[model samples]
Target: MDSKTQQTKWSQFLSLIVVFFFWGFVAASNDILIPVFKKWFVLSQVQSQLVAWAFYVAYFVGSVIFFIISLKSDILQKFGYKKTLAVGLVLSALGAFLFVPAASAASFWFFLAALFIVGLGFSVQQIVANPLAIKMGSPQTGAHRLTLAGGINSLGTTIGPILLGIVLFGMGNKEDSAPKDVNLTKIEIVQKEYQTHKDELAKNVLELRQDNQDDPAKVNEVIAIVEKNIADLDTQISSINQNPGANENQVEAYTTALGEIKQRSTNISYPIGFVKDHLKEVKMPFIVLGIAFILVAIFMLFSKIEDPAKEEEAEIEEGSAKFSIFKYPQLYLGMLAIFIYVGVEVSIISNLPALLHTKEFGGVLEHNIAPFVSLYWGSLMIGRWNGSINVFNMSKTTNMLMKFIVPFVAFAIIIFANELSGKDVSSFYIYAFWILAFIIMSFIGGKAAGKTLMIFGLAGVVMMILGLVYPDKEIAKYFFISGGLFCSIMWPSIFDLAIAGLGKNTGKASSFLVMMILGGGIIPLIQGWICDFDKTSPEGVMGITWTHFSYVIPIVCFVYLAFYGFVTPRILKKQGITMGETTAGGH
Candidate 1:
């Protein structure tokens, strides 16, 4: 704990953060790919979200495998952090390589399987990286150092979309956009969902007929309703196909139906119409990513990265009694909080691309989407930069000044990033106002985990509400984008709170928290499903209109998170733990 050991090992820490950069790079990159994939494969917004599902669920799956293996022995302790992380990278590398065949074959499911493997590698990397970040610095400053690492992760997120955008669609000086083309025969997703709805309608009708054998009229009325829905969807599909064009409502409602008027493409941006060329474009990005992973894995294995001394099974923290996982309310509640927290952060950016495509919004085509996506992810970077201010180890007055100054500095970085990627930076000038407000809120939130969580969670809830209510779609879109601002530091706050008093159970609790990263996958798919809810509801509004209304899902998630923040402190105090006192966190 002396000054020498207290200083963070800058060189070693830099080496470790490379993995963090790539994690955010690939993750934020997923949002960009979601729309591209939707266009490429004629996928529903719901089906398109399988990109996130496949990637994040692998974290749950990998963590489970790790947990099972650890019951016999702690894997990190046995293999050591550096080697374990290397192995994870290799696993991810193999997964990335799988993308080649997946793209070459134009198989969406295969791409998912490959992405799942990438997520599995990240699961291991996440496990090692979080603890390793803390160990790289002083015990007292470990959490602050982890915040700094999270900042690096955010940096990755900020640039990921921008760079990926250029890689996908270079320097934005383009001609006319591609025609909306989708394959009719390959509209299996629509057919599958249709069958599901049909089966449910049939089941309901059968039950009603059984109960109302004497009242055939009741069952017949329900049958008419079901048939009307079926016919409506069919007519909508047929109208668009016969004319070779359709309104956005019809397209969003049954996106895969555009497949009926399939045509080839001449533009690489719209190359999905030309199946062969478009599928070929997909391989290069992933293959390049895979090679980078393998090279990093090799460097990590050979590099002189230090591993902290491992603790024994009996490593009880001072003044703490061993408690079963059942006794920890914060642990369980915080698990779900972590789940919801990760989900909302991810879903906002994931679905924003679709939101941007609508006429009510900017109606920007795919190439134009990078700026908004970049800004959303960049918002996280801004907040993380502020959160990492403690890394400066300056005077209290300087720390306060840094808190105010650092966020703007991060904003500058974001602006610079957009410019570097050859994107329009004018719209970003106004977003600085939102960042300014977040800076003020950050002052109000301070350092306490519970207070920060409650405040930020509620802020997220309000932003979503405003996004729903705001009349101007142009300005309203920023409300949705501001979600990243609120979500910035939630991961650490929830993580520290969750493991606040776990003592010897700390490592195990951490693993479970990592498993909850699957929320990243689950929430977006739910929102996308809501976005594609093509039928009319009892309220007489089209469920497809829920694209604008799907903000409700994120709203509910923030509400629970705010509740968790409000209640978890009281829950932990009963076990004699202070709210702010806690362990490290990772993205």
Candidate 2:
């Protein structure tokens, strides 16, 4: 309740945001998986979106379960924040571990289950962390601390796609030295002859189809001949490859050729009956992520993390007079705000790969989509970083300059990392100007979470509208991607508004708010269904182009958020509530 106790705990704050980074990393990386799953399984848009559904729906389930348990007892209060965090990390690690089996089996449902486990872990973390961030510093500047933590979260989002791309696509990877199992002399002869035969046979089959246009019998005969040749060539290559006397050169050539055959063949099947090469590669990064979570959990067990609730036990007892968090309309409305905000944010980013892959949209190559995904998530980091500047202990002038500089600094970091990963970032340079607009909006609304929330929410709505309107224009891409920039500050802003005066109920309120993460699950599914435009039906009935029309989901979401932002402050004022001492000393 006092200003002195409210000063930010810098070291503890830094320690806490590690979980935030993990949340962002895994969440954004789901975008990459969506397209991959769709292509591999030949899934409908709705079917592939089970990725988002399985992952985000866990939050609602976990939070509801947590809330029910708390009806009898406060779990965080009993277990303590540090222990709760460690447990969450362990759960997350367990989830990541599931990816190993999921990928090994190449089971799509297994992958969903793995993501669900991860989401459950994140739910607990969100329940604990959101309230914890607010309580870490002065009640006035609590929003700023959360914003700073979100900036760290955004950092993970920015890097996740690029790094995961490397793992999945083998981009920029160097070939290892050739294996020493090949019969070098015979290997060369076999490989050369195989390639010659393969090419000639493939060409002959194509010509047979064309030349035998009126002779099905002749076409079948030529196809049979080519198929037999291919089968015989494979046997010869296999015999040479398995020979112990084979040299490294021969082994390498044979290995490379076999891989090419798989790549070129339309109906390629994995011999292992589970993980294929690409799926296995994708599984590697997640397995490593699982290991990292375990290590972090171990560290958390030993680390001395303060529980803000414990420090204010007496005040909490006093504030405990109110048991039901829903008594406050702001809390309930804010809960919906969090839900819609998350739903729209996830829907846009998760579907971006699909949108870009469409011939009607950007049509970006599968492997090349990482950088654009990075841009969407990175844009969030830029806005959050800008908002984070207010939380730092700096002169007013310094803060202003940094507000402008920090986003572009974050932007530079994204561009640099992406460019190094082989993505051309030149088109994204214009986004910095859009970022400048974000900066201007930040200063215009100052530091009031509710006011700024309204402003940013409206801005988000505008961006979505532009994206929908000019769905095909190059400029529309900027409009759609800039939605992240507008959305960056909303989580902290809405959280700050919703829990402003809830006192002891803040913890319960946090759970309810976290439950709204269900929106992330449902909204994308709805968009996917809409994206399944029945081309067979008369046009325009579904609203817009299937891809573009789906964006309307986000537009409606932002509209609700903007209205919430506009009304919440007035409601708080009528109830004599004000966030006491903001980082900028306002409101």
Candidate 3:
């Protein structure tokens, strides 16, 4: 556990983060997939979120399987970390390959199954990699190593959207491409405005329908107003449809709107689920990513990475700890923390494009918003890269300079990636200040995981509140997106603190922590449900109307995290394990 021993495994440690990178790439890419799936499949907001639910819920299910297997025998102990990781990669490859058939069949269930398999694979990978990252170095610097690996993971997140967008939308060379008849510009504006007002319009119609016992005169007046609004919307649709320039796609879009308007009337009902359409355009990307997963699996199979816990193997064999990790209250709290951490992180990014497409919020299209999505994930990269400077054996002056320099360097990479994908990123220069704030925050914590967790968690709460407070302001969108920066170090911080002195119970405890990823599945669905039109009032049986207000879910999540951060150190102190106090060569 000393610096000298930790320094010896540097090469194998370097290769270990490759799995981390893939996990980030695919996870962030799901945000891109969400809107695309929602549009093509005609899914409701809550229904579209099944994409996240299917993907993340697998972590819980897979961890439970692993936990059950461990109850019978130590899976990781028997198979070893390297083999477990390789097996996970192979399983993920199988999952990625499923996307090909899923797309070909145009089956939403197939897509969910593919994602579930991928998450199942990730379950094993996470259990192995998180503990492996910790075990590779001194216990004191375990979190730092995990933070450094998270920086690599965030790099995948930084570019995942642009790359996936190029593959999904095929818009990387838009300047040289001929225009389609879709009338995207008009559709973009109208869809944003119409979606913004549609909920209120529907609420009014429902209220009017509920007034059967009211005065006939008043009922007639409300019905007349609703009819007039429908007529106006129909007139606009007719104009768009009759335009000389209108193409098949535009006409189809208008026809869909007319259908929706009709469905909103008293005699008709709106369809409330995903519609299956034969979509062959998005097949190749899945096939390609699946093949890549196999290649990575092969690389891992032959790689030089060692069994990470060989030193502790004998002790583990002789140990007699119970299967339950609940004995440690910190572990249970950390499980909750992981649940919400992944929940808040996933939900924020996943729903962002939904928020951006609204006229009242960002008013950006799916194609145009990839860069912003890139920035949200890149914000994490910026913070982690800065926090990771200590992993290198450098001089204090060098470390300090690199801490300041690394974040902007990461930011430049994000900009360059966006530009390559035909996006104009010059508008993002303002985020440099937020990047600086993250750097300042990193230095304030000074390599302490608990301290950093508290600072960053509190920052997440403040930023989310700013988003809710100023939902109509441009700063609100960016503030909510900036939650990624504050969330950058939370996993490492909370993971290290949770498993700190568990020793023999660490593996089972790790499984328990991974199980909490169920939060990612549950929280986003809750947010999506809250954003439903039925939930128009926060105090009602439903929730609020504004899309931005759904952010309260993550705000609540971060509050618990800040509490965990503030109290975890005290918990560790009770066990006489004080972290971040020993001065090392790196920090």
Candidate 4:
């Protein structure tokens, strides 16, 4: 390439990286939002997860629309990359500002509306960015460029969670004031009655002992008399015996007392009900976030993109036969791979914090320790950094090998480190595993083939299953976190491979690809539903645990990605393009 062309390509590359960073920060921030919304709204595990669902579902819906448009004529040919991206940015900013009202209203649906808008903005950004990046470089180095972009994106993701955590969850406020209509009066009345009864029982026991101290038989007689009197009083109090023609206040008091007794009895009958009820309140934020994500889809109609190449192609096609890009088998497979890969990624990050805190699996670290958990995200950033640094100098086979070996070794070390530390693994070891996995995946990913890198996703699934099967051990718990290292490169790598060729059709293809992100939204909701189901079921029956449900997500992700690894690149090749060569705007 000439110096001017090289510079143009370089400029585009930098711009796409900026785009990735923005979306990465936004996407990963959802992790922090999940727990925060859960707390703020008092939602259940299932409901709180809609934050992911709302955001990702827009990708699916938006991309499908873009894909359809591409079938008519490339949308970029009509609009252009710059205009399209600007619209996306404006929509994103609008979505961010929407949070102001959502937070104030504390209405769950409002928050979801904001999140849906944000997701719509992301659909545009993603659809434009991936193919554009591929266009800027050679096919072989496409993965490397995307990897670099992924690293920057990871950095944004790392910072997003930390920043949002501080803003939302770290405010040192624990008292969640109840809404106006929830009627806490009943609870307060019950509490007061229980306290009064407790005090009376103590006083009666002390008096009975004192009254019969001189003779053992007298002591027994006094005790029996006091117990009978207390029992009679308790029966009257529980029954709330109201005389005929009582005043309104007295009637209310009597009914309140009876209701309290019934509630107490129910609590005794079902111990987990209270916890489940509270969990339901925790999911309100996620619902709001989901709605917000979908609302932004409307912005796409007004958005436009700039592409000089697309304009040139349009002129040539003025009298030619209309071509449909959707007929390409390679593109279909690529879209599926992206959908599955992102789904796995979202599920893993969403669940990692909870998994690390489980006492049954030796997650002794408290939620207060954000630094330890940060390592999981930090590793992805580090791996991306290494990929960027060496993108130009590495061979394909070498890159593939490095990617595979790093994650494998990282998981192995995590297992060994946990076992060696015994019951009390220092928090430092937890941090070390994070650092080690990042280094390994980064180095290996910098040299491995895109296909080989995708295979590591399977390793993550296997580790999650191990964690579920042996929930009694700390090592099993560590495996789930370790899966992060293996998962680190899968998204960028698979993405670069999928849109390998489509030339001017790259923009539409990118949109189609971004739509696959709906996997992230849907899969987690499924997992959350499963978790709620398990929590509600009988202990020893068909009930599945949260950890077990987590295993299913990655297993499905890897199984699909592995198929893509072997077949997707070839399909793209058959379509007359290599796995990393297609360019629309930048990817």
Candidate 5:
């Protein structure tokens, strides 16, 4: 077939990445939501993870719906990419609107349902966007092009948490402006929060003592925090019991701890700032996002974004592919790689709060740890920007120079976004070293997706291991945070390798790959359960070893990714696919 696809379609590619931005905005915002949801709902660690579970699982469900449609006729081919993306945006807008009611009711399930719908719409955008990213540029540079798109997506992840925090913590119902009434629900939210801190502190003190019985200074460090937090919890419980509307069980909760109070725990409305109750502020951001989504959809309707095969399809018989989609090992194995990649990516962020709250780590609350989470996602941007540099035609020296320059620019963007939102940027500057390390690694991976995946995957494994066993707690947390760096380019690597030989079936294969995003939901649940699954602690209590050591889960995930990286090239080579060569743009 005679070819018409350009070496690069910068205009169309630019339009496409706006959708990528929305995906990142919502996805990274979920990390912020998990802890907030837990705090609002009085949910245990495991239960709170349902926020991520419900959201990511929808990708699988949405993919299934579209995949079934493809069995009859191709949706992407029939509807075209712009129409499909517009439809996806409209669906996402509807989900975003649901949050208003979700907030009004303060129902956790309602919030989960809203997130699920948003992810449903994202599933469609992802199906269209990824392949389009590849097709918009030289096939040889497809993986790097996708990495460039992901860097744009990472920009969303970088700012999403900050803007979301502004909405969640700094918005409606100003703390000093409101008067206190007596609603037990507010009291319960406060009580659970204090209790959670107390429980985590207690477990940390225990772990510290066990780790070194001789280190009384270390034990005392945690002992003071544990005692203070428990005192706060006890005082909160007394206040709960003082309410006449409290249930029998609610009163007994305190009675078993200290003694009894005169009243039941009920009828206690709180001031806006009381225990940081910002539930009313949650919907404002989503409402804004919903409006934005509708506008984007309208733009898409008028937009000129074209399909991948649109220009080339005229030269070939439309339905004349001779191979089955299943016969490709790249597709099947790539499906598993996508699952593992999405799983590890999501699981790391979702469980990170638990790690931070560990007394050894700092006992920081979720809102306070936004800088860490922001930097983690920002690490992806730093790496992707370095990888994305490949999309341009440049000399090897120029490419090397861009790799050195671009990652820091992306880092500066993260710094500016977070600092502008009032987060301190002083500590975030040290993260530059990690970015430097990734830059060194990107040079090693070159432009080949398989080689890049293999190297980066092993790097992820090493980072996770350091997070697990590294002696310096401060540096160790950074090690764990570096998971985002290694992960930044894996999606393009796997996607590029998987669809190598499947010309027309790329969309179908992509649907299956997108469906495996179910990992993002399920893997987090597994890790979250592990966070709560302490045999040493009784039921309903937070665990000790699992918080820091739970990093082992990602270690396993990265090991498989590394394995896939090693074996995939062999498989692709057997099929006469050489993915490791320096791609079209000189590297």
Candidate 6:
């Protein structure tokens, strides 16, 4: 590449990175929204997840419209990238502004509508930005550039949960008292009491453990004896209370005795369970905060970008009517690849927080801690960053090997970790496995675009199946999070492969690709309906559970993606034009 062309390529790469960052921030915020809506709207588990369905479904719907427009014989040749992006920005901004009203009225439908509009805007942005990134550089460098963009996008994901957590959960007291209106002294008292309770619980658990080991057979017998004595003391105190002539000092002594007895009972039982239960009770505010955070992210995107269509005209003249890009079989298959990739990605992230919060799966951590789901985002960032750097260094075959091996190893680690910890493994283990998988996949992606994605897609299907079959919560969460590792490269790889050679027609084809994001919307809703339906039982048999149904979404998405990976690229080669080329459009 020449110096001037190199500079232009870098600039274009930077612009797409910004777009990716925005999308990552906006898209990942939906993870926070699901639990938030569940709390704010008092929705059922399935109902709350509709928040994701409502937002992502727009990608599919909007992309279809854009795909149709692109078929109008080089519509992008008439409009250009700058103009298309500007229009998308405006629509996204309008979507963000809608949140203010949605929040004020607490209207769920309004929020969904706003998210749909935002999805439409993002669809346009995706169409324009993705192809532009590839065209500005060589295919070797293009994936790297997109991966860098994915990294910045992960940064936004990291910040989003923390920022929203502070806004929502940090402001509240656990005792059902509104921190916003409470006096400082009362707040301090509440905090002190909370800390005291936590400390006391820790001390009691240690004491109970010691007691249990001191005499395993006699511990329960001793506990029952202590409980009976306490109950008898309580009855004696009540009898004293019934005496009309009881002295004030006698009453004070009885009260003190009752307090001592209660303390002894708590020590015997180990109060850690009670402390954890109280912490769970304080999660409502955190849920609300998560919702607010996403609204703010939507606002940020809307304010920052503009609609590309309104900005400028394309330098290229309209192409002859002889060639039609839409008629190509590879192009259609490529669109399917994009669709499935997005669906798999969305399903993976959306389900993580819920899995961490499910008690049946031995969720010991509180939901407030669930926002740390950003750790998965952090892992993705690491992968994309390394993938970008390695894109230039590694050969296709070497990179492909790493991608396949990395996820497999990560899955193994997660399975081992879950087994070791058994039912008591912390949620942090989920994040660890995710990071490990991402690292391996990044090395694997190298420069072989189509094959890299194919590997990831197949891995996604395997992980989803594992999650469905496993009854263990920790194992299920591990598989779900590991799906992220396999999924990390599918989006950019599939995109670059699909639009490989469309010259002047790249922008229009890009639009078609963006429209496929509607998969995010459609798949999640379908999953939601499936989950809801499963919860409804017949007379004798149990209903389908979320664990079983959740697998269906990713399985369906990956099955398509796997097909696209193995078959779509070869089909593209047969077409005598890559996804980036302006060939005679064929179906």
Best by lDDT: 1
- Model 5 residue-pair collision total: 10
Candidate 3 residues 1-587, lDDT tens each? 54545653677778888788888888888888888777656566678899999989998998898878877887777988878888898899889888877876677789999999998998888888877877776766676677667777888888788888887666554432212224466554454344434444556566566555556566666567666666667576557645746666875566455435532432321221112222454567667777877777777678777675555755754444554565677888888898889899889988887677543453455566677789999888877777667766899999889988988999899878887887666667777888888888878877777888898889989989878776345567778889988887777788778888887766657667778888888888888876665333423232223456678888998999999989999998998888753111110
Cα RMSD for candidates in order: 11.7, 12.1, 9.8, 15.0, 11.7, 14.9
In model 3, the worst 10-residue window by lDDT is 269-278
Give the per-residue lDDT of model 5 (tens digit) for 302-355: 877667775554433353355465699888888899999999998998889777
**Tens digit per residue, CA lDDT, model 6, 394-511:** 7878766665554444334333432332222244544555565555554454356666667767777888877767766545656776665566666666766676666556555666
Model 6 regions more than 4 Å off: 1-5, 8-16, 44-46, 60-87, 131-143, 171-327, 363-366, 392-446, 500-505, 538-544, 572-587
Provide the overall lDDT of each model, using Cα atoms, as 2-decimal numbers: 0.76, 0.74, 0.73, 0.55, 0.73, 0.55
Residue 237's lDDT within candidate 1 is 46
**Model 4 global lDDT (CA atoms, 0 to 1):** 0.55
Cα error of candidate 2 at position 511, Å: 1.8
User: TM-scores of all models?
Assistant: 0.81, 0.79, 0.79, 0.64, 0.78, 0.63
Q: Which lDDT tens digits does candidate 4 get at residues 1-587?
A: 53224433565566557667667667777776676565445566678888889888877777777767776877665677666666676676667667766665566677788888878877877776665665564655555566667666776665655454444433321221111123435434333344444454456467545542245565565456546545644665554433444555765565444434422222221112222332343244334443443343343334332254644446434333453556666668777877776777677767655444332332222223233244455555544454454554568787656655544444343334323322122433544554465555444433334545555665665666776676345355556656655666566566567556555565445566666778888777766766554335413122334544555667777777777767766666677765432211112
Stretches of model 3 off by over 4 angstroms after superposition: 1-11, 133-145, 172-278, 308-311, 317-326, 395-397, 534-544, 581-587
Better of 2 and 6 by TM-score: 2
How displaced is residue 88 in candidate 4, in Å? 1.2
Query: Which candidate gets the maximum TM-score versus the true structure?
Result: 1
* Candidate 2 per-residue C-alpha lDDT over 440-494 given as tens digits, one digit per residue, 9 for 90 to 100: 9989879878788889888988888888777345567778888888888788778
In model 1, the Cα lDDT at residue 512 comes to 88
Q: Write the per-residue lDDT of candidate 1 for residues 39-80, one digit (tens) a residue.
A: 767677788899999989999999999988986777877888
